[model samples]
Target: MRTSPRAHARVALAAGAGLTLALLVPGAAGAATGTPNVPTDLYNAYQPCATDPNAPLVVAGRGSGVTVEGIPRHTSPSAYYLTEQFRYWPVADPTQIATVERTWSTPGYEATADLPGLVDGSTYAWQARTVDPSNGAASDWTASCYVLADDTFPSQPPTVVSPNYPEDRSSQGGAPIHLELGSNGVSDIVGFQYSWNGVFSVSGADIGEHGIPHYNDPFDGPRSAVRADTLGGTASVDLMPPSPSWIQDLYVRSVDRAMNPSPTYHYRFRINVDAPKITKLSNAPYGKPATFKFTPDAGVQAASPVVSYTITRFGSDDPVVLPAEPSGVATTTLSLAPGETMTVSSLSANGWTSQRNWWRDETDTTTTVTSAQFPANTSSPAAPGSFHFAPKTETSQIASYTYAFGWSDAPTTVPAGKKGELDVTWTPPYSGWYYLVVHATTKDGVQLADTYYWFGVN
Candidate 1:
């Protein structure tokens, strides 16, 4: 868009490092709270030749902020604009000598120019000419100047490299966000905080009681908007249910210590929730006897998430959902019937059906766990019955880290349609959570269960 000396107009526009834009509104852009600039009458014939020894440099055209055509440097890059020409100034002049700026322009030649001046966030208009030592060919005056940026008001925005210009991206429940950000221009990065829908759940499955996944904000310092460790081109974080299965248009926003946040980035994704997978079966290592807890080598499908399940002895039509006193996503203990069979399955999200099966109808008298086959986190210290559960989650934040281990005199019974509770007891050799592995049970001695979970310890 070209600007004339009549209406002082400037529109709101974003600028890239090497690109410049001049808004031609009657006022400045983004100044929703201010008025636009009015064009002034520039009838000055021409700027006199420079008195300095330099020959290629000509006086830039004049205006409130007559400035250079581009950034000034000792030498020009490959594509720098040497100068320009203009039609008669005051546009009202008809017989003017085509108004060549530095007299270097050909007769009847015209020029126009836009320039960003010394002020960091301001722009001004003026014409410029290039002089050649050999022939002194001055180009016509150029006008229509523009300024690139003015981020000095609220705070200094981070100088992010090209793309990853924005701090955060959006994601859904099962489909996580793979963030790639470049912080080459930023230094002294303390770290970054992530808020999805809202800040991540810092209490529960996240860092838990362990001194990790901590959060202290306004985050008062200059830090990368992403995380300190996420500079290696890629970072993986799982998307969990804020509303879980209830889908919504979610967004991610990040800020620097200067509190300059990238514009909110958003996307549309639905949570793909499946019931947690129960991989194998066994007995608990430390938790109470079989009646209270039955071990199941369970795993969550990396591609699919199973949120809930049901557990019952074989041949029993009544199978109670796990997580006995289920609050959120949970696992539960099913009481064993001496001669009865057991069945465990991954429950569907829209509600349950026989569609998915995790484990099924295995008799207690037929089940057994070789002392050597049991993981030490549960059985190592017999008095305490140490055990370990490998609990893997499909989430990026927290959730799959808790374990249900230790002996509960009364095997917490999983009521019909509901799940049971796994007793928690911290002992030696085992430092975290562990639940029973129901799949380990076999047609041998009556061991019924063992503690083998899907997880990792801090």
Candidate 2:
């Protein structure tokens, strides 16, 4: 439990913080039977950003609100304040931006007021008080809570420099790289947060218990934060990247004291020292499974035999792990579409992993439908044209061809000829560009990928 604001304020005053509070006697004119206690626990009411360093930087234009609550006195004769008042104003100018009053027969009610708009880079202060509308009596205002309205991101990204692994160049892997993070003209920047794989979580410094903004140890939290030197605004760290790639990037962001994050600075470099070699073992036609082998580098395999290969195929973000054979080589069969590629990384018996190696398969993607009478995009409106479709290969046995003039129309299907050839005729619909999609169903009941044909009806 937190200390009562009355007691805490007393203590703060005793400690010579120059704080003061007004006390009205019970007999004062039109005063309530018992005085309402000054409000306690004033903070940014936006729960998502209410915690710690985030509270101090209120996101302007997001309907951010402030909250303050009053705890009723528990004396024998309790006071029932009928109303609560909450208001916030610019810190520099005392003009009120907004104010809210709530009626509450019960005490200890929370008052929330929304800030529909605030000037960027400006600071605002808020306070709350309890009042008795019938008697026109009110408690002294609570200590003010301050928040900085910051709609702007940090000015710029962190200035990054690396000695061991310079930018855009290859360097030996399996060792830590020295990096120096410096400020980029953002005066309030306190540290740099970075990650090897561009995935990161955010956190900030804890605010003082009294809702006062204090910067005593802002660097204590944040899993990836590196505090800069207080005087020079620079810090150095040695970071080791796991699972190197042909082009590795250390994504870094500058974090201000208020926890505002800057744009990412991609610290790019290469670390392809001991990657596995990819070789095509067999060539199968498009849409058919083909075999490829992954072998570790000679020097790497001598020390630690390859155990498995991690392969990430194109069109998919997930990686698949394939165990290696007894000969320290791994092979996998994959059915890939034309122009698809995959990246492979090998793990060794000694728990070391090689860098990523890229491989591409040569799969033919020739269009099965061709037209001579209607060379693409040249036919006028109502012009009739004939299209011819043939099997992809002599071995491929297509049953029928299903095609549609455009996405909105119903598709028409025609049986293939004895020799697996298809012929169709259609009149142009309009003098504009149009597209036709065709899907071929193989005799084996497997549907191959769809082919798109684009042309214009002049």
Candidate 3:
């Protein structure tokens, strides 16, 4: 039907974005900024509001240009119907919505309204409608929001690129597919939701279903989930696809709620994607303050991000390691001299890694007390036997420590100790034989024997 020009409607999953494209025409001839915008694709672009800034606004995004729908018919010879409505789904779905100016008029149409916003990690459906009175009647509404993608959705998403082992993704198993992901443009990410159809891990789903872990090795087993976002980039996961196993369908996307997404800016993981490798690691200067460097067979990432490199010296400050490039080879400096050693480790480029990787414990106050003596109280005749050892950092085997007491006849693995008096205190597993052996290895064994020795009570 014949109608007057009017404002269009726009419905998108997100609504906080807009652009003002400059024109090639002269300043006098060009359209003002934020005016009635015309686009190549009328399906996605609708007038965000009615009677907005007169200056023409430029639209930019996927699918070429924006489009306007539901032009309004003239309501009267001097007046026109301005068609308008809110950009939203038929039923209230999980989305961010806002009122848009949808109208049609005789001369032209325009709108001014606040844009709607959507929630993260949610699915949203939207459409547009307009109200205009150019030909004494307004036309019907139009369907939008279901814009088609020119290319197929990514079957294999991006992934974290390192710290993967050979047995991460095992099927038959040979050399598993290793994948890692990192984010430079955004903050750290967490709890990745991933999947594999054999070769690839798919991501971006809200539920954790359909995603797979990159556990390719039986020996490698379950390591604590390293929060990928702790690094300078957002949190990213790393895994190696098992060898011999054919990873046909794999997917991975990370969010607190598995596949659900929060920020538009994020990093994904993919398999069969090769990045830089660190073949060699060394510390030069080997002085009290050593500067460690790594030469990767493959090039490093373009960025100069720092990871933590820990070494043992009498005293020194820690330094953050930086990545050479996007491919992943990273390095840093350390200071050490004769008789000193530095334990190398990684710290998240961000504060996150501090909790898990940045710090190390060389001595144990609660843990290395090989033997101890407590005061003989009147509670029991046997003094409580005690010893301390720091918690194990890397080993996962069942640790069994035995404590020998002077009075125990059987294996008194862990018991209390007493002095010349008949009282004694010891460790918990009080079942085996124990003897108060006068430990001769004091100062010899880090002076543990002298500080940790005492005559036992019978």
Candidate 1, residues 1-458: lDDT per residue as tens digits? Answer: 12333323322222221112311112111212212121122222122222222221212232322222211111222212222222221212223222222212121122223232324322222333333222223333334322222222222222331121122332222333344333334442323334545443121111112111212233333322345453212222333333333344445443432233444445444333333334323453222234233222122323233445566555657767664222224444443433344545444343322223334334332212223333534433223433322212111111112223344322432211111112233333444443444322222222333344432232
TM-score of each: 0.22, 0.45, 0.24
Sliding window of 10 residues with minimal summed lDDT for model 2:
10-19
Error (Å) of candidate 2 at residue 73 is 6.8
What does the lDDT read for residue 84 in candidate 2?
52
Candidate 2, 243-320: lDDT as tens digits? 555678889887775456788899999875788888878766556688887887775577567888899988788999
TM-score of 1: 0.22
Which ranges in model 2 have alpha carbons more than 4 Å from their true place?
1-35, 45-83, 95-98, 101-111, 115-117, 132-137, 195-222, 240-243, 275-353, 356-458
Report lDDT (CA) for all predictions: 0.30, 0.63, 0.30
TM-score of candidate 2 versus the correct structure, residues matched by position: 0.45
What does the lDDT read for residue 264 in candidate 3? 28
lDDT of 3 by residue, 286-335 (tens): 12233344332211111223233333233557534454433333554443
Residue 218, candidate 2: Cα error in Å is: 9.7
Looking at model 1, which ten-residue stretch has the lowest summed lDDT?
203-212
Best by lDDT: 2
The predicted structure with the larger TM-score, 2 or 3, is: 2
For model 1, the local distance difference test gives 0.30
